[model samples]
Target: MKHLRYVPGLVARGAALAAALAAAGLPLVAAAQDLRGPLGAAPAAPAAPAGPRNMSESVAAVVNDEIISTYDLAQRMRLLIATSGVQPTQENLPQFQREALISLIDERLQLQELRRVEKERKINIVADEEDVDRQLGELAQQSNLRPEAFVTALRGQGINPDTLREQIRAEISWRRWIQGYYGSRLRIGEDQVTLVQQRLAAAASKPQYQVSEVFIDANRVGGMQAATAGAQQLVQQLQQGAPFPAVARQFSAAATAATGGDAGWVSPGEMPPEVDAALEQLRPGQLSAPIPVRDGVYIVYLRDKRGGAGGTLVNLKQAAVALPQGATPGDEAAARVKLEAIRTQATGCNDLEAVAGRAQGVVAGDLGEAEVSDLIPAFQEAANQLQVGQISQPVRSPAGLHVLAVCGKRAAGAAQLDREQIENRLYGQQLSMIARRAMRDLRNSATIETR
Candidate 1:
């Protein structure tokens, strides 16, 4: 399953919902406030003291008449700390408690809905124990531990592993329920898919980014200030070596949250304007700071980037002589002499190894294969100038002096958009919009009290 991650620009929900969907890292998404509203104003229980405190079975809050026990809230806090790798401290404890409480309340609401649907509709979307175990095993695998060992680690941290299990259960059930309820009703016509394809083809000339994201929804977290603070806390944990995917799965509100926020290859203008701008400044492996836009805060990680329309792919071999950075004219002359001599004996790339081996202080081997435009400027010029199986005059670069051999060249095509993928993206987006509205309606109609 695609795990309910949303697509952007597929279905027309309200602008805010569309923007929220777009903000996440999904295949195709067109992709805040003070902390003084109900959630922020709702008093959270005091943070339990460090270490194992006495268990309290008293009510923490009531959601639609379903009780959220203080014990439940505490367990979830421990679970959040264990999974998110966020430190539980006096300063951050209240924040953690609030987040945990909200999570618990949401779960209660979801379970309530699931129960209502199953009873009234006679449809069982409830995830069985086996389903929970399967998810648990997958999560454990992500941590590079066996399920038993993963449970032990959580126990070691004084967290009840069952808390994590129950959370996973809710997630699975909710995902199933949403998909079942809305999947059939949403439709993507051939025309819609074609339109997306046309858009993708038109944008093929723009740079594309392989990105992953973590979106903190301001409304869900209480307000803009609260979301920002939470984002900063998450960022701190990320910088300290917490895994991005794991944290995203636990905390990000985007549909991509299920798949660790991998957006795949997104062209310019695909992401929200602020996110797109942030991506422009990010290099591969770099993580952006929390970017506040109209609807939420986004933290993007650029996995890679590539030029538009692709380029000529080439294979080559080289013979080179190393020179220090500050090499004098005399040193350059000497290195050139060595490479020129090697070039004569090396009739083609086939002779690169043996001919260069005969020269003193020379290094030679295949330079591998890569797109011409992706190469360094010096190499790009050399590859373009040289013919297949031909050797070039000595070239000077920052590395040293080199004689290049062009072994092969081929035109690489840009990635073409797929119709099925486009259709699926659109369908997923519609379902996501429906799910959001359904949840909102549920929250609005339900009687809820928080303490």
Candidate 2:
């Protein structure tokens, strides 16, 4: 019954990846054409190869004895530019290469783990080709092209479509692997949800911010200086024209990076203290300079804000048993009796529609969400009086004898942390943390060499 906007799943994340790239203002193939110059200009030619007869055969990095080839890095770099909407200049080429290489390494590690798991368990954990195709369809649609056409565009840009495909495969596989491994073990108790609810209620009078972020982990990128530099560059790109979500998808190290770095609505103490301070200074639609946290730098984008004490919004559902405009007392009484029967049988809003279906002449559906005060007097009174999932006794409206149910409510500027939402939030946080730790362990034990 809660009108919460749940976090997106794998397919949605994949769609967002393509959507962000498409919305970045870069022409489909122009990104590749302008690697060494501003868009619409000819790119500079590369110098002759130094070592390998086939330059693509040259090694870029070695991950646990597996090689990531120069060709692989180049394709990924182009994909990065295309997806991130960052103008590839000589100044940023090294940075892009580093990012591309790191991404390649992570994918290698993830694939290795998947193979290990499959071998050990004798089960296939890899994402199916159909899943890849579905994700590709979403990506292509975002580019305003059919799947075949989108593939052509990538090829024209000298990008191997398989680069994108493999990236999707790795992400899908890794996500599934993590969720499968940890989901059942993670539990969110009623007490945890209640604690979060209590915290939210306490902060209900403080300001609330709708925030998105780009986090650069100092350890991942090398050190504090490098992370700070990366954060500064990302902030610059965002200020210039790069889409925040697009950049976020490419560079943010936070778990929210999977969903374009959306941190959703947060109160004062919800985020790190430093980030909270930075957010306070930002107006809606403004970007904050990189703020140094203990392990990383954060670039926050304030999407919107509202005072904590805003009006109440309600989600309502209604069942109306119709009668004639000037029906006889018998008719009204009969309608009320029918409605009362339905109400008594209905335990909550979840089953209200089905319960109403049992009786004739009963029309049951949601009245939808609205501010409590904005609802008409009859509905408003009902909404103000009933708690979530509580059904009202039958009352006569102009059209019929009606019973209303309160499905959910929230303060205008706040997000409702319902039981399901809290569980999901905790699940994601733990999963991401575990995944990161797993990757860190792999990195620690593996022999990685860069060329």
Candidate 3:
């Protein structure tokens, strides 16, 4: 059954009634100052020291009338640290914990607002069984695990499957509410889309200059002065006709230093704003004076600029084979063999399904047509190598193994956008900003209790 899940404490009738009454300037049952005290101030120090023995039951703060347990906050912090791959130490753990707590408070607020909105609108958002099943299937496929294995993984993480499902359902319900309330009013006119297209085209047409640079690290001992000296010295060498790549390979600390810091052709938006600004003033073969970035100094020299707008129309085709959960190592081997057979027999996308079927696999999906750069590195390489109607060898990706065929190709040139497209893009930007503000306000007004 569809359920409307309310965040505890924030969803109570008394809380909602109190908020309405407060907004209407009614006298409070208790001192307004007492209730408002914690709203803007830093959290009070814990009554006792937080250590292993006391940590589980510690009260970090009270949100409205609810307590935020220290253990819950710690669990969230650990998850965040794991996902970000950051090592938590004594120096950083406190900061991380604080940030995690704030995030929890924000989430609670959002959930509360979702509940309030649902009540006001008299809507019951339910998660259909089919939707739940589909989601679980997808999750299993992603983890390369069977349903049972995936459930075990969740259990190992100390997560309850029912709680996780409830969270997902709540999120879905809130999204539906947002769409019903504001989706129609969100307008993206043609003019905005056209403007965006024009900008994209203009950017594409601009000459792309490849450059090599060296940044002297300033954070190490004697680093700032050494980098500064190195920048001046490198600039003099460039003026003396020393090769930029040679100097970059010898001195730059960046990853590209090995290749003489050869930053491939970059357009305006492709670089940091400061770098883009500097590049604008530089002509081909010109070198810049020392440019300072964070904790370093850079010596840059322009290598070459080439290419104007209009690139070729590359027709890219892909056949993906999605493996279902419970597929073992044997299943993976079978999938690969099947893909190879399809590749051997395929002439074009038209032959994909038949070939796949013969091999006991399926044409799981298509990526349709794509620009070369729009594809991932492996797919891009395969696509670029293929001739029209030629099928590629099966390649593995995170999504699955794919066989590509290039159906068509086009060369680069100048293109312009019509007016309608411009307006729509602009409208999208405006709507995004509006939505952010609305969500922020909703959060600020919510009586969130985190426990």
Which structure among the candidates has the greatest lDDT? 2
Name the runs in model 2 displaced over 4 angstroms. 1-56, 310-412
lDDT tens readout by residue for model 2, 215-300:
88776787899999988888877888988877887888877876788899899877899999988899889999999999889999
Worst 10 residues of 3 by lDDT: 28-37
- Higher-TM-score candidate among 1 and 2? 1
- Candidate 3 lDDT tens digits, 7-114: 111112112222222232222111111111123332212221222323324665655555656554644443333222223344444444554576456445555666
Candidate 2 pairs with clashing backbones: none
Order the candidates by lDDT, highest first — what do you get? 2, 1, 3
Candidate 2 has an lDDT of 0.76
Model 3 regions lying over 4 Å from their true place: 1-56, 64-66, 125-137, 158-170, 207-432, 447-451
Q: TM-score-based ranking, best first? A: 1, 2, 3
Residue 377 lDDT, candidate 3, scale 0-100: 90
lDDT of 3 at 284: 74
> Model 1 over residues 152-260: C-alpha lDDT tens digits?
6555544566676677677778877776667755677878777778877787766788998888877677789988988888787788886777667667777666566
After best superposition, candidate 1 residue 422: deviation in angstroms?
A: 1.8
Reference-based TM-score, model 2: 0.68
